[model samples]
Target chain A: MTVPGTLYGVGLGPGDPDLITRRAARLIEGARVVAYPALAGGDSFARAIAANMIPATAREIVMEVPMTPARAPAQAAYDAGAARIAEALDAGDDVVVLCEGDPFFYGSFMYLHARLAPLFAVEVVPGVTSVTACAARAGLPLAARNETLTVLPGPLPDAELRARIREADTLVLMKVGRHLSRLRALLDAEGLLDRAVYVERATLPVERRLPLAEAPDPAPYFSMILVTKGADPWL
Target chain B: MTVPGTLYGVGLGPGDPDLITRRAARLIEGARVVAYPALAGGDSFARAIAANMIPATAREIVMEVPMTPARAPAQAAYDAGAARIAEALDAGDDVVVLCEGDPFFYGSFMYLHARLAPLFAVEVVPGVTSVTACAARAGLPLAARNETLTVLPGPLPDAELRARIREADTLVLMKVGRHLSRLRALLDAEGLLDRAVYVERATLPVERRLPLAEAPDPAPYFSMILVTKGADPWL
Candidate 1:
């Protein structure tokens, strides 16, 4: 009887090859099969980050998740991806699924984890998240002492975003691609424009960091705005 | 004229040596001078995380930061440490200050960065945080889509903590040291005890994960409670 193999969801930290953990690097190099998600027709950022470390002889599984607001298409893609990974596991081949940032923090790997965890042995290797990456690049300390840090998506409604931003001691607004203009206006209204720092492609060669006031009109999907309210708590 | 050496704030990730990034490992291995904070009379968590990677030839700087509610003692310790590091930098030897988690996210390195950044070249290498580590160990997806994630310090006043917990879509209560019983009671009051997962010393050999209701009282300072309201968002 062949023992089923374990599925490892490996996090390749925010687009930096050097940021990959030693554990994740070793896993990628030793895996018999590797899996990652790609945009419907675009390249895989996760795979690209770990490209140098992945063994050339290992088989690759690419799940083409559609870039759409509707959840069904992406869910279907993950469903398909999970099935393929299960097949590999059943065949006693350990599969390493690459995830951008930490696997359980807003990562697509969670979708597959939901489906496959019940039947297979799954482990999550956490990675450096974009929140910390942006903070490091922007030279900002997120929260200190008893301060509260709030993370919100830019696509959220204005009222909710405003209330949360006002309540938060430090804020990280993520998925700021199409919503950059509106998010800027909202922050400006809350008197937080000067406090906000916009960062995109953190830890990468082409990374950009500027005050939110000077950010590009249409920021990239990977962009984020970090705002630390009031005085510097650490000081 | 000798060029003053750059100060690198390297994040070692949560406790596991393997979780350290390749960049951080490389920095530690090649470093000539290393600095880290230690409890006034105790061992340094940051140093222990990267002890294996640190070169035998490296000179160590231990800053004995007194663990007190008053900030004056710790600040003075950092001031003294920064002076020593500055002297080394003036001598043209790069200093690597080891940080246990992402340096910019509630890390002690931020204090040093604030003190030395004005006079020296300082760069922060981001690493996996305990928040993500706890999430991964507990198999909990932090936040997805438009959900708001609020991170609160468990030491906050009861009223403030209760209000924030109620308002948050997903909550991560950090610094769950002496407040474990109180936090558990608060969560129970909000009907969130079942939804909360307690994780302590994540990724280390001594890591513990359990439901909040079953967690031990007097949890360590490294402990955290992750609570996700409502049904599984991914499912």
Candidate 2:
């Protein structure tokens, strides 16, 4: 009887190889089957971050997760990926799934975890999120004492976004690609434009930190904007 | 004349030693002087996490940062600590300030960074925060697909807490020590009691995860509460 192997969902942190945790590093190096999500044609960012650590003899599984607004297609992709991961687990091969950020924080790994937890022994390893990485790179204190910090997705309606900006003590906007213009206007209306800093590819070689007003017209998908309402003495 | 050495503010992640990033490991191990915040009586949690990696011959500076509601004493402590650190840097000793979680995210390193940035070179290395670590430990997804996640300090007025709880799709309440009862009542008032999960000392050996209702009467200062207002199909 072959014993079922455990499935590990490991976070690789935000783009930098050195940011990978020691626990994640050990698991990635020892795993017999390594899996990561990729676009239809592009390489996996999570896998690329730990490329140096993964053993050459390990079997790789590159699951293609589409980058689309529709949730149905994405759900389908995860379902298929989970099945592939399950096959390896059933075959007594411990599988390591690479995730970009903390697996449970607005991550794609949740889709697989949802399907696989009931059937397999799964463990999650958290990592340095872009939220913290961006704040560090921008040299901005995210919150202090009793200040409230709000994290909003960019696709939210302008009215809700404006309301959140107005009420939040510190603001973080994620997924700021196409919604860059709309977010800029909302921050402007709330008089938070100057307080806002946009970060793209934080902690990476090509990282960019700029005032929200000076950022390019089209922001990258991985970009985020951080706004500290109070005066920044460090800046 | 000795060259002024750069100061490195390194985040040590939540609690797990293996969770430390490679960048942080290198800096901590190679630093000439390592400084970290310590309570008057208790050992520094940041130093304990990296105790294995720090070089035995390195000079250690334990800065006593008071745990008081008043900010004046805290500021004074940091000011004095910064002066002490400056002496090391001025003598061409690169000092590494060890911080738990991301340095800029409500961390003590911010106080030191504000004082030292103008006079000396400082670099911040981000790490995994308790927010993400607790979410992963509790087996809950924080936010996804345009959902707004609000991080509130537990000291807020009940009315304000209730209002933010109503408006937020996902919420994380930090510094949840004595205010656990108040926070529970507010969640109940918002009909979110069942959705709340409390985590203490995440990633540490003494980690605890429970439904908010099941958590101890007096929550530890190191605890946090995560509430997902919407239906979490992944969970």
Candidate 3:
């Protein structure tokens, strides 16, 4: 039984229902109301991932989160939505906010959590993050001991990017769709492009992988670039 | 849909069969053989997580990694395991090794990868590392945007530990069950002992969470401590 005055921030796992942790599933199934963020497009893939697990009788609330890269107006929109969640908790309605990965790992759920959690008791139900799921799908390890693994968002300064690439033995560059060509070049400049792999919508049923040179249409914004210094250690 | 020369390394999500990513599941189901490292106890948790996913008739190879703190014997055992895998691939079988969490995070997979990868096609699948999962399970975010997050194993010089705690906004101390008292003292010195959370077997069915003080028999290993400096942003 849940203690009073509590909110659960649940992880949906990366766009796959079966990937939800059993704990997350139980929480959602029994939650008084299951909350999720959506855009004008409606129920997001991440939301759908966990929706199947929540019983049909449970209330599903789609609090919109601006999907476009956040600028002034977008941030304003997120603020407004977070306010809606706050209003819910005032009525003693417990919420289970569905996030794509571990709610905090580069997912949009943080915004909602930030806004709603302050006045309410909050507990995070961690789910598998996409990086792990991607690596799992790729059948690759994140790093070897003392091998140094680096996680670089696509927007870092090129020098920072290069230094991370030079320093780490394994690198998982996230949000690289827009920066694919630039990242590809960086890898090539470092002579490691041939060792890179592209994973698009990893762990999703529609997932696919390819050599860095052969990836189709440079992946969606959800794509990542995984590079290794030596060879696949498990080979 | 077989790729002639490529080998896939799939990481099963830590200890939970249902937590395995859909793509990891797909690959395992399709692979001709599945391999996993076993310790003294047989039918490893990693293997158990992948069991339902693999083909019913697929070959299962077990590489026994020693269970000890020693180095050389462990290294040699990994070398032998790598040799056996090499023999399998030499026979033209595509092998998928099930690692509990991203194999490279901390495991024998890295040793085997180093030994066999250069000579054969290989891939590393990442799994839910204990840190991210533990942090999430504990209802804490690892770090905010600019806050430094340090990942440290126990047994570091006290000086290094102090420096890490001083620099990082979020500290994930791994291998701490045995070293609990030392960690407790360090956090106490930093005035964070009460705020610290001990997470054991995070995301698994039997996962447990308690304040550092509640750990009656501090486990010295696999347990993680998440120390957060920011006002609970998601609280």
Candidate 4:
């Protein structure tokens, strides 16, 4: 008999169907229910990447997770979302929560997991992080021997931003959407502006890479900057 | 007609057959010639992975790569390996050089790539990194949001190692073979020894993880340590 109240947090990988791990694919395909967070009615990247692995007859639940910044409001939204996921687990169904990239790497799925892991069985399947994805897409090494790799979110204070860039051989600046211009100035002051490569939606259908100095605002949160020594390999 | 004198660096994705990316699988399955790095006499994880992706009829070339501390000898080994790959591409055959993890992530495949990419046509397909694979196997997040993730080689000077341990939220110590004991002492001094997880032969058939205190010298070069909260998730 199948175990009840079980949850599988599957990593859909970096927006490619084939990149899904064999174990993740199996859990997803055999799942009695599958849930993925969505911004709206449109298809989510996580869902699309995991589209192939999901079986035809499984129960598909597109959970609408609200993006709220406030503590109380966000907690309410998370509670409601967790309730929906719990409903499936309570029904004795094996539910697979599909997440883009790794589930724990700044991903929103952690909320649902934190609420449920203590009361139920939970397993997280790791996927490729965007740092590795973009580095590979750019045909460059993330870090060489004796090199330090640091991943800093773009919203950090100017001091933190400058410190991270100056402290490592390689730095991946995530959340570069609205802060591209500020980061560009920071990199310029640090003398790393010339070597930085801005990659947006790396490994996705609309993936693009350009020099960070020329990158204007309007990039997405899925974007990142891979700054390393050496010229762009594609050039 | 296929272009002559073009090379492809394909990511083998850890050591599992199923972890190979779909793009990598298509390229390998379609390639006229497949090449992979081997220590000697042909047995290699990269080749075994690519072999599972392609049909039985595909041609194979095993490039011998000898890792040496001397710069001159290593360069010669890379030069010879690149030359062997050039032969297949010269015949108007699509050649795929399979590499473990992402091609540019600390693997010897990058050496061959550096030699051939300038003079020949080249394409690189990034796959799942071993860090990600090992993280998946352990079911732990490598680093969370706002967490400092530092990947060091474990042979760093004592002061540098101590500083890294003090500042990072999540630290991954790679290339840890016989230096395990010294590392354990350092972590103990930093009060992180109990929390450290040591993994050997990550994602391979005999992969195993031990508490930092119990690790003997059975681990190899490819092994790693996932130190949770190496960097504080939140400041």
Candidate 5:
């Protein structure tokens, strides 16, 4: 029996190729096989982020994770991908699974890691999360001193979103794509619209940063909204 | 008048030298003058994280930032540090201010950026936050799907902390040193203590991960407590 090779969940950081960590770069570049999730038949943003570092001779496993409201298909895709990765590991071949942002922070890589860790040697390399990237790009301090920062998804019930926003000194709202209008309404009702900054594809070449009030009606899935309540002189 | 050199706030990532971003590595390696915050008469963790990348011949400016409860002295130290950095920028020598974790996420770099942005060109390079690094090291997914994650300072009033914790599906308690007992009490009251995990010096050589119940009464200042509620199968 061959010694099971290690499976690496490598975070490429937020879109910019330069933002890739040295450890992740080394893993991705040296791996003989690299896997990444893509929108069925679409290009992989995770792959794009680390394109500069991935060796040209490396084999790629493009897992087509459907972008839909249903969760079943995504789960199935991860299971299949995990099985495939496990096969390579069983064959004594290390596999690098590229992930956007930090692998374990609300990332798809977690699903694969959950499925594979018990069977094989798995390692996780962290990266710059979108929250930090957006905050840096927006020229705002996320939180300081003892201030609390809350992160909420846009799809949450309006009341819950509003309550969470009100409970914290700083807020970062993710998954603000189709729920942008509803999110905007909630923020407006709470008079937080003026203080919110919207960021899209942060750290990428096509990054966009704007006030929440001026943001597009239906924001892209990759967008984020940050709202600050009090005066933060650093911002 | 000389062309003022840019002031770079470089995030060294969560205690691991290999976690440093390529951009931050370049800035640190090329910088003739570098600055890092250190406790009075103590070593600088930020500098230590990026020690491998910083040029040996670099002029170091170790700003003694007091860790006392008093905030006034800390602010005064930042002001002085910013002034010193500004001097180098004015002299056409780029200065790299080393920061641990993302520079804009609850970091002192923001204070320096706030003071120097108007007078000098400043660039912020985001890094893997301790939150992400801790989550990865702990082998747990922070948030997924529509789950809300709230970050609270350990020093918050117990009532406030409980309220915020209740609002979010996931909680990350930062600055959990002296406040561990109070925080543990709040979590216990909410019946969430069993789900909590404690991480200290994440990604570093001296990293520690354990159940919050088993953690030391007084965790280190660099420690974090993560509490997850409900079933997140990905975790």
Candidate 6:
């Protein structure tokens, strides 16, 4: 009987290759079979981050997940990907699944984990998240002392977004793609536009940081808006 | 006159050395002067994480920050440390300020960054935070989709904590020291004891993860409580 091999969910960290953790780098370099999700007909950002580390001789599994509002297509992609990954594991070949940013933090790896964890030994290597990356690039200190930090996705309803933004001490609004204009207006109404800093593709060569008022409309999906209210407590 | 040196605030990730980013590792290895803060009478956790990579010829500045509720003493400590760092920068020697976790995320390095950023070139390297590390260790995915994630300090007032806990979709309560019993009671009262997971000194040799009900009272300062209120959306 062949013993099943372990499945490793490795986070590649934001977009910068230099930000990849040593442990994640080592895993990528040593893996014989690697798997990663990519946008259908688009490049794999996760693989691109760790491209140099992945051995040329290794086999690659590309799960083409469609960018859609519906969940069915993405679920099907993961189901197919999991079946293929299971075959590798059943054959006693460990598979390293690449994830951009932290795996468990709104990462697609969670779907794979939910499916495979009960059947095989799975290990998750944490990576630096985009929240901290945006914070670093903006030179903005997030929450300090007892201040509460709230992370909200920009797709939430306007009423909910307004309430959350109003109550939040320090806010990080992610997935600011087509919702940029609405978010800007909300912050502006709250008199928080001056304090809000917009960051796009943080740590990458094409990264940009500026005040929310100056940010482009329909910002990239990777963009984020960080707002720290109140005086600088550290000072 | 030689140009003033740049000051790098490098995040060392969680306790595990392997978790440090390649950029942070390179900076530490090539640094001529390194600075980190320690508890007045205790060892420096930041320096200990990067001890192996720090070159033997590098000058080390250990700022002993007294752990007191009073802010005056800690401010004085940072003020004193920044003066010494400024001197090193004036002599054209780059100083890498070692920080555990992301430098701008509730990090003491922010104090120094605030003090010296006006005069010196400062760069912040993001790192894997304890939140993600704890999530990885606990095998608990934080927030996903449009779900909101709230991070609160355990030191918040009881009423505020209760209100926040009720409103939060996903909660990460940090600085769970000396407040475990109270937090546990609060979670229990809110019928969330079963959902709350306790993590202490994540990614370290003595790392521990268990249900919050089983957690020790007076938990370590590095401890955290992660609670996911909703059913697994990915599943």
The top-ranked prediction according to lDDT is: 6
Instruction: Sort the predicted structures by DockQ, highest score first.
Output: 6, 1, 5, 2, 4, 3
**In model 2, what lDDT does residue A67 have?**
83
The residue-level lDDT of candidate 3 at B24 comes to 69
TM-score of the second chain, each candidate in turn, equals 0.97, 0.96, 0.90, 0.90, 0.96, 0.98
lDDT, candidate 6, B1-235, per-residue tens? 8999999999999999999999999999998999999998869999999999999999999899998999899999999999999999999999999999999888898899889988999999999999999998888888888888999999999999999899899999999999999999998999999999999999999999999989999999999999988637454
Q: Is the docking of candidate 2 incorrect, acceptable, medium or high quality?
A: medium
RMSD for each of the candidates? 1.1, 1.7, 5.7, 3.1, 1.6, 1.0
My TM-score estimates for the predictions, one after another, are 0.98, 0.97, 0.71, 0.91, 0.97, 0.99
TM-score for chain A, candidates 1 onward in order? 0.98, 0.96, 0.89, 0.90, 0.96, 0.98
User: How well is each residue in B186-231 modelled by candidate 3, as lDDT tens digits?
Assistant: 8899888888898887767778898987874667355778787763
What lDDT tens digits, residue by residue, belong to model 1 across residues B64-177? 999898888888998999999999999999999999988877888888888889899888999999999898888888887778899999999999999999999989999999
In candidate 4, clashing pairs total 8
Q: Measured with DockQ on alpha carbons, how good is candidate 5?
A: 0.71
Candidate 3 — which residues are off by over 4 angstroms? A1-5, A30-32, A67-75, A86-93, A214-219, A230-235, B1-64, B68-72, B75-99, B109-127, B143-219, B225-235
Which digits, one per residue and each the tens of the lDDT, describe model 5 over residues B1-235? 8998998888889898999999999999898999999999968989888888888899998889887777788888888888888888989999999999989888888888889988988788998899988988887788888888888889989888877787668889999998998898889888888899999999888899999998998889999998877436543
Which CAPRI tier for candidate 1? medium
lDDT of 2 at A174: 94
- Categorize the docking of model 5: medium
Interface C-alpha root-mean-square deviation, candidates in order: 1.4, 2.3, 4.3, 4.0, 1.9, 1.2
The DockQ score of candidate 1 comes to 0.77
Residue A19 of model 1, lDDT score: 91
Number of clashing pairs per prediction, in order: 0, 0, 19, 8, 0, 0
Ranking by lDDT: 6, 1, 2, 5, 4, 3
Give the top-scoring candidate (DockQ): 6
